[model samples]
Target: MTANPTRLGAIRTIEASEAPAAFFDVTEKTGAIFGENVFSLSVMQKRLPKSVFRSVYATIQRGEKLDPAVADIVASAMKDWAMERGVTHYAHVFYPLTGLTAEKHDSFMEPVGDGTAVWEFSGKTLVQGEPDASSFPNGGIRATFEARGYTGWDVQSPAYILENPNGNTLCIPTIFVSMTGEALDHKTPLLRSEAAMSEQAQRVLALFGHEDIDKVVSYCGPEQEYFLVDSAFVNSRPDLLNAGRSLFGAKPPKGQEFDDHYFGAIPERVLGFMHDTERALFRLGVPAKTRHNEVAPGQFEIAPVFERANLASDHQQLLMSTFRSIAKQHGFECLFHEKPFAGVNGSGKHVNFSFGNGNQGNFLSPGDNPHDNAQFLVFCAAIIRAVHLYGGLLRLSIASAGNDHRLGANEAPPAIISIFLGDQLQDVFEQIAGGGATSSKQKGVLSVGVDTLPDLTKDAGDRNRTSPMAFTGNRFEFRAAGSNQTVAASMVIINTIMAEALDFLATEIETSVKGGTEFNAAVQAVLAKVVEQHGAVVFNGNGYSEEWHVEAEKRGLKNLRTTVDALPEYQSPEARKLFTTYGVFSEAELESRFEIGLEQYVMTINVEANLTGEIAKTTILPAAVRYQTELATNVSALKAAGVDADTADLLRVSEMIAALRAGIGALDDAKATGHDHEGLAEAAYYRDSVLPAMLQIREAADEIETFIADDLWPLPTYQEMLFIR
Candidate 1:
C-alpha cells in the first residue's frame, strides 16, 4: 500500500491472462449438476409419493390449499435430498419490510438416545419457524419486548442450496409474519397479492369463455444492472463503504462522455466473476440468460428468463447475494447502489412483466393483428387503467433513499409513472376509443444502411428507454426500480393493482352482458370506457425532458420525486382501500409499511450525512491542507531564491482550500440544526437543504483533488476504480 501515483494506473491495463480464469469447470458435469443444488420440482417428484407430489403441484399451480398429510412426506423428501447435498443446516429465507433478504439458520441435528446425534428435519421444521420479531423493524406492529414472529414455508418457490466457504446449507424460501398473524415481510403480502390477482383474473377468463382457466400468474424477468470496483479502492473510499456510493470523488477527466464503455468487451476479471455467479445461480434453478457490458464503466447487467413473480423474486435475491459472495472470491466488490459514481450512468432494475396461464401462453402477446386480438387489448387496458388509477402506489413501490439519486436523473427514468404504449399500440387504442374498425399491419424490416446487422424483421413499435413504464412487444418493462431492490415490491404492486382493475372490468362486462348486450359489443364498450378514463397515463414522450414534466402535469399524472415524497402514498386512503379490498394488505399492514418506509428514508440519509461529515473532517480536510502547505512552502522558497516565483496556480489552490473549509463549516451548521428526521417534512428538508450542503463540500474537495499532487491525495479516484478490471 505504498503511496505511488501510478500504481492504480499501471494495474488498470493488465493483460487478459493476468486475470483469473473464467469459471467453466467441465469436470463438474454441469447438466447433471444443474438444479442438483436445489430442491426443485424434479427433486420433489423423486422424493415424494405420487399423491403428495400431485397435491403440492396443485397448491403451486392453482393456488389450492396444501394438504396437511402431504406436508410431512414432502418435508421428509426435501430433508433427505438436502442431506445428500452435504447440507447439515437449514434456514428459512425471507424478505423483510426493510427491502433486503433475511435469514436465520438452524442445524438439522436432533438428539437421540444415549447422547447420540441424528440428522433429522421434520415437517414442522420445514413448514414453520419462530424467530424474534422485535429485532426487526415492525413500524409499530410489535412492541419492543414482543419477540414472537413466524416464518411459514412458501411452497410456491422452490428451496435452494446455498454454498459458503464454511459449508453448504439448504435455504427454504418462506414468508414471515407477526405472532398475531400480521404480515411482517415483503413475501407474505406478495403471495397474498398473487392469490388475489389470480382470483380476479380467473373471472375475466371465465367471461372470455375460458372457465377452465383456474389461475393467472404474473411473471417477471428483471434485468439487474450493477457496478464492480476493485476491492482495494472500495475499502479505501469510506464514502462508498458506508453509503454504497461515492460522496466526494471528482469525475475523472475521461468519464462515459466518449461512450466507449457501453457494450464494450467484458474485462477478463469481471468475466470470471460473472461466470462464477451464473454457475451458482444456474445450480439454484435460476434461468439466468443474458450478461453484457452496460452503459457505464465497470458496470454490467444480467437478465433471467421470465418465471412466476414469486419464484422470480426469490431467484433475484439469490442472484444478488451470489454476485456479492462470488465477487469477494474474485477480489472485487459488487456495488448495487443506484448511483455509485457521480458522472457515470446509474444502475436500474428493468422489470419486464406479463400475465400468463400455466400452459405458458402470454396474455399480453398481441398477435400479428394486435387490433383484432380483443383479449390482448383488454389485458393491456387493464394495465393502463391500473397504472392510471394507482400510479402513486407504483411509484411508492420503488421508492428508497438510494434510488432518490438515480430516478428523474437524465440517465434513468423520470419519477412520473407513465406508460409507453409505443406507436402501434397507441394507434390501436385511439381507434378502439373512437369506435373505428381495427386494422391489421404486417411486420416491417429494419435496415441499418450497413451489412453488420442483417435485415431483421422488426416489431410494430420502437423501444423507449426514457419512459418509466414501457410496453415492449409482449410485456411492460417497469424501469423505475433501483438496481439494488428486491423485485417483490414492484411485482406485488403490479399484480394487486392489475387485479383490482380486472375485477372492475369483469364486473362491468358481466353487467353489460346480463343487460342483453352482445359479448363483443360489451367488450368494446369496456375498452372505450377504460381508454376514456385512464388513457391519460399512456405517454410516449421523452420522460427525461423538462417539457414532459409540464405536459404530465397537464395530463394529471402525479410526480413523486423522492422517497420522502412518495412513501406517504402507501398509507393513502385510496391505496389502503385498493390493497385491503384485493386482500393484498390490511389497512394496518399498509400503515405499518408506510411508517417503516419513511423511517428507512430518514435513517439512510442520516447515515450518509454522518459518514460524509466524518470523512471530510478526519481524512479529506487534513490531506488537502497538508498538500496546500507544501505548495505554499515551495512558492516561498522560489521567491526567496529570487526565481520568477509563479504562484498563480498555487494561489488558486489556496482559494479552493478556503472554499473547502467554508463548505465544511456549512455541513457542521446543517448537522447542528438537527432538523432532519423530525418527520416527513424535516426529512424532505434534509434532502433539500442538508444533503446539498454535503454535496457542496464534496464538490470543493473533488476540485482540490484535481489540483493536488497525486502522491499527496489520500483517497482513491474514479479513474482508478472505474478503469480497473
Candidate 2:
C-alpha cells in the first residue's frame, strides 16, 4: 500500500495558494491607527474628570500607588471607552508561570429585574478577579484542592481592546497571585524587581547631585526571530505540531550555507502577513520598528522600539499572539521554537536592556567621552559587578528545554555567561582598572572608493555576534534569550542583580565621602574597586570558539550547559539572598520557581521522547519497511528474468529499518525509567537517557528518509517545508 498523500497534497495546496486580501496600507494609517485600540492615558484624560485623571496619571507615569477612592471613576471611564469600541466583554489578562498569557473573561451585561441587560463594571470588579489556581503550573504553590488565585489590576501597564470577528474584549493587564499575595505569575516578580532596581538606582543618582528624580525603569527592545512554514505542511508534521520542532526530518540539500538569505527580499505572502501583524500591533500600542529576513531561509525577524520592561513584557506576549493569529489568516504557521529545524540557525530573542528615568535618560549610554563621565562609569561598573557575581543566575534565567537545543550550538551564544564590552569601552574600563582613565576611543569616518557615495560614520569597534551580552553603543543586548520565552524572567534576574550591585556601590561611595574623601574621588575609588574585583566576566573574544571556553574556565566561570544544570542555580545561596534582600521574591516564591523549572524541563523531554518513538514506530518504520519490500521484490523479478540486479538500496533500507525498531525499544525503556525517579533525578534521566535515545531513533529515521521513495514517505520533507513557500 502507498503512504498517505498529505505531504504531496500539501505541496499542491501551497503552489495554488493565493495571498489574502490586503490589510489597510500601514504607511498611510500608521499614525491614525496607532494606539487607537488601547485605552491609553490620552483616552483616560478625555473620559475622566480632572481630579480623577490626575490621580490615575500619577500612578501610571510616576509609579505611585493608585488611590482606591478613584477606582470607581476610572473603571466607569474605562468601561465606557471600551464599550464605545464594540467591546461587550472584559478580561483580566495575566502572565502565569507557564510563560503564556492567561485571561478570564466576564460579560458586562447584568440583569436589573427586566428581560433586557444593562452594562455594569464596578470598581470592585475592575480591581480583581478569581481564576482557578491549581489548573495552572504554580511550582507546587497551590495544591489540587486549593484553587484560589487572584488577578490584581496593574496600574503601570495600560489596558487595551483585543478584537475578534465575533466580539471584542477589553483586556486589563494584571498580576496573578495566590490568596496570601505571593506572586504566581511572571509580571508580579517583574514589577517587584523593577521597584527594587529603581530604589537603588535613585540612591546612586543622588550621589551625582540629582534630586527628586522620577521612578527609574528598565527598558527592553527585544528582537524576535522565527520561521514561517505553510500551514498545510505544519498540519501534516506530527513532530512539529506536538513538539514544536522537527524530530526526524533529514537536512535539506541547500541550507543557509550561502548566507544569501540574510536580509534578503521578503516573500510576497510573508510580507502581507507582516503588514497585518504590524497593523494589529500598532493598534495595541506596540511599536514594532524593523522587519527583515534572518540568516536562515524561511526565518525572519521583527524588532520593536524600547519600552518600559513591564509594558514591553505585556506587549511581547501580545506581539507573539498577534503573529500567530495573523499568520493563520495568511495561510502560514509562525514557529517560535528556538530551533524548529535541525542543522539550521535557531531563533533567539536578543533583549536590549538599559535602565534610567526620563530626567536622566539611559544610564548605560557612554556619550561622546565615557572616560570623563563619572556617572556613566559608575552605572557601567555596576552592570559588570552584577553580571560577574551572578552569572549563573543570568544563565538560569534563560534556560529551558527548547533553548538547550540552540545554546552552545555555535549559532547562538555559548552557555558560559560573559559580557562583551566593545573595544572602545573595554579600553576605558582597562584604563580605569590600572588607574584613572584619561582617554576614550572616538568614531572614525568611512570613505567608499566610489566618489559618488557620501562618507559614512563608522563605529569605534566591530560587533561580536557570538557574544552573549554585547554593549552596542547604548544598551547591552542579552543574546541568549529564546524566541518563545517571556522576557520577564530575564528582566527579573537582571533587575534584582543590578539593584544589589548599585546598592553596594552607593554605600561604598557614601561611606568614603563621610571619611573625608572628595565626591569625585569617592566615585573613582568605588569604580576602580569594582573593576578589580569583578572584571573577569568581561570578554572581548569570540564566545563560540573552543579557546574561549578554556579561557572562561581559567577565569573560574561556570559553564552550565543544560537546563538540568542551570535550573539548580535558582536554589543557590547567593540567588536566595539577592532576591530576598531586594524583596523581589520570598523564599517560598523562589523555591516554587525552581521546582517549576525542573518540572517543565522533564515534561518537555518526555513529550518529545514519546513523539519520537510514536512517529518512528508508526510513520517512519512502516515507510521504510514498505520501501525495503519493493526493492527486494524488484531484485527477485530481475533475477527471475536472468538479469543482474543492484542490491545496495535494498540492503541499506533493511539495515535502517532494523535500527529504527531497536531505537524505539530503547526509547520506550528509557521513558519507563522516568516513573522510577522524581524531580531533578527525573529531569536528569530525561536529559541523559531519554534525549539520547530519541536522537538515536531520529538518526535511523532520517537516514531511512534519504533512501525511501518520495511517494512512500509519510512525513513532509524538510526541503518541501523550508523552501516551498
Candidate 3:
C-alpha cells in the first residue's frame, strides 16, 4: 500500500547514476588495443631470439610441453615486456576447486645491495610457484597440515597483464597441483582431457586419408547470461550481497511473461556497461563478440568468438571478474547466480563446442552433401555413441546446487542429457540406421513479399532451444551448463567421453579395413551399428515435455535431478575407467573430485539455510510483527468507537506471522541438525531436510511480505530489483 524508503532510495540512486565515460581514448582504435596487454605469439616473436622464439611458439601453437632450456629466455622476455608497462608484480593465476580464480602475487622487484632494486623473474619462478594446498579444497588429495601446492605454467594459455589504477600485474595462467602431483584445480583436468581427445581425433583424421595433421584442439565459445541490478539495491539486501541471489522474493506480476525482453533493445545503461567490459576483455584478448538482451528483465548475454578450450576457460573466468568490477564502476552488480529471481527465466552459459585441427576443419561439420560425407557421418556417429554411453556423465558435469533450481524449469535444459539432431541430420542418421543413406536434404530459399526485399537463404534444419545438447550447424551448444560455473568441468567430461568414442570408432574402422573390407563400407558398417545402439540418446522433440520424461525413462535414460543424485556418478566404475584409460584423471584424482563436489553441495545449502533464518529473524520477522501490531491496534480502536469493523485483515496477518516464526525455527533446527553426516550423506541431508525447510521459510516469509505494509518491508522486493533498472 505504501512505497518503502529503501526501494525508493535505490530507484533514485539508479536514476541519478550515469554510464561511465569511454574506457579508451579516441586515438586508440579497438583493433589496436586488442591483445596489446597479452604476451602473444607476435609479442614473443618480436622479443625473443629466433631460435628461442621458435621453441616457445612450438609450445603455444602445437600444445607441446615447454622445453626447460627455453624457460630462462622466455621468462626474461616476459619480464622485460611487463616492466615496460609499469608492472611491478606477477601472479600465477589458477582455478581452484572453489570454482573461482586464485592467485599468489610476488613482486618482481628484488633488493640488490645498498637500497638498490632490480626487476627479476627467474625461469624457475615462471615455471613454478608455491601456494598453500591445504587452504584450497583438495578433497582428500592433501592433508590439512600438508600445505604444499604448485602452480605450473601453461604455455599454451598466453600470459596477460592486468591493469590497476596504482600498478599492474603480469598474470600467468597456470594449473594448480599438489606436491604429490595430484590435480587440485579445474585447469589440470581440462588440459589432460584435451590432450586425450586430441590424440584420438588425430587417429580418426588419419583413418580418413589425412596425411599430416595438426594437433587437434577442442574449441569453445560460451554464451554467458546474467542479471544486472543497481548496487544500491544489492547493498541494502543482505541475502543478495552474501548469497549472490535473493533468498526470498515474491514473484513479480510482470516477470518475463510477454516475451518482450528477449532480444529486445539494449538499455542505454547496460550498453555502457557492456562497452566498458568489452574494451577490458579486448585488451586481454578475450574476443568478446556478441551482446544482447536475454529472456528476463535486466538479464543480458555476451558471447566470445571461438578459442582453444584452455584459453577459452581462462578467458571466461576473466570475463566474469571483469564484468563484476566494470559493473561496479557503472553502479551495477552483475548477478551470475542461476535463477537469481524465481518465476523468471534463469541464466545459463551455453558452451558452443567443436573440435578440429589445422589440417582438417571441424570434425562435426556435415558439409552440403552430408549423406555422402562418410567422414562427417563417422564423427557425428561418434558423438551419438559418446552421449549414449556417457549421458549420465554429461548430466553430472553441469550438476550444482544453483543449477538444480534451473534445470528442467523450462528456461534451461532438462537433466536428462540427449543430443538434438535437427531434421536434416536426423533423417541422415535414420537412413544409416535402416541400412545406408543415399540422399541429403537441401536448403530452401525464403522469398519476401516485398519486391525491394531480396530472397533469404534458409538453413537446412531448424534450431531447438529446449534440448540439452543441440546440434547448431557445425557445433553442439551445451545449454545445460550454469552461468556461474567454470566451463572447464563440463568441457572435461565432453572431451574425455568424445575421446573414448573416437578411439573406439577408429579401432573398429581400422580393424575392418585391415581385414580386407572396403574403407567406405567399413565406415558405413561401424556408423550403422553405432546408430542402432546409440540412437536412443538423440531426441529432437521438446525436452521440457512430461511425455519426454516418460519416454526418456522408457529409453533407459537416468534422470539424475539433483546434484546429490548426479555427483555419485563421479565414483562410478565407468567414470573411473574412462578417466583412467584416457589418462585424464587418476583413481585418486577421481575420488578426490567426488569428495570435493559433495562437500561443495552441502556447504552451499548450509550457507543459504543460515542466511534464510538470519534474515527472517532479524529483518522480516520484526517488520511483520510491527505491521501485525498496527492492524490489531486499528481493529481495537475501531471496535472501541462502537462501529462494526472487519477483523479479517488483522486475523490473516496474525496467522502469517505465526507461520513465519514456525518456519524460521524449523529452518534453524534443520541447519543445526545436519552436521553429523559427511560427504554424500551430508549433501543428501541438506537436499532432503535443509532445502525443504528453507523453502518453507521462504513461502511463509513471502506470504508475510504480501500482507505487510510495503513501507515496513526491510528488504527490496523482486519487482524493484528486477525491473527498476
TM-scores, all models, native as reference: 0.96, 0.99, 0.99
lDDT of 1 by residue, 456-566 (tens): 898777899999889999899999999989889999999999999999999999999999999999999999999999999999988889999999999999999888889
Off by over 4 Å in 1: 1-24, 27-30, 447-454, 675-677
Q: Rank order by lDDT, top first?
A: 2, 3, 1
RMSD of each: 2.2, 1.4, 1.1
Deviation from native of the Cα of residue 112 in model 2, angstroms: 1.9
Worst-scoring 10-residue span by lDDT in model 1 = 8-17
Q: List the residue pairs that clash in candidate 3.
A: none
Residues 1-725, model 2: lDDT tens digits? 22448787888888899998766664666899999999898988888999999998888888988899998988998999999989999999999999999999999999887688899999988898998987888787788789999999998899999999899999999999999888999999999999999999999999899987999999999999999999999998888999899998899889999998899989888888998899889989999999999998999999999999999999999999999999998899999999999999999999999998889889989999999989999988999999999999989999999999999998999999999999999999899888889999999999988899999999988898898888999999999999999999999999999999999999999999999999998988998899889899999888988999999999999899999999889788998999999999999998999999998998888889888988898888887888898999999999999999999988888888889889999999998878699888888989999999999999998898887898889888888888888
Q: Please, what is the whole-model Cα lDDT of each candidate in the order they appear? A: 0.86, 0.92, 0.91
What digit string (tens of lDDT, one per residue) describes model 3 on residues 1-725? 22788777888888887777877664678889999999999999899999999888878878777889989989999999999999999999999999999999999989988999988899999999998888899889888999999999999999999999899999999999999999999999999999999999899989988987999999999999999999999999988898888899998778888989899999888888898889899899999999999989999999999999899999999999999999999899999999788899889999899999777878878889899889888878888999989999999888999999999999988999999999899999899888899998888899888899999998989999999999998999999999999999889999999999999999999999999999999999999999888889999999999999999999998899999999989999999999999999999998988998898888888889889999999999999989988988888998999978899998898889888888988887887779988878899999999999999989999998877888999788888888777
The reply for model 3, stretches above 4 Å from the true place, is none
Model 3, residue 44: what's the lDDT?
92
User: By lDDT, is 1 or 2 better?
Assistant: 2
Candidate number of the best lDDT: 2
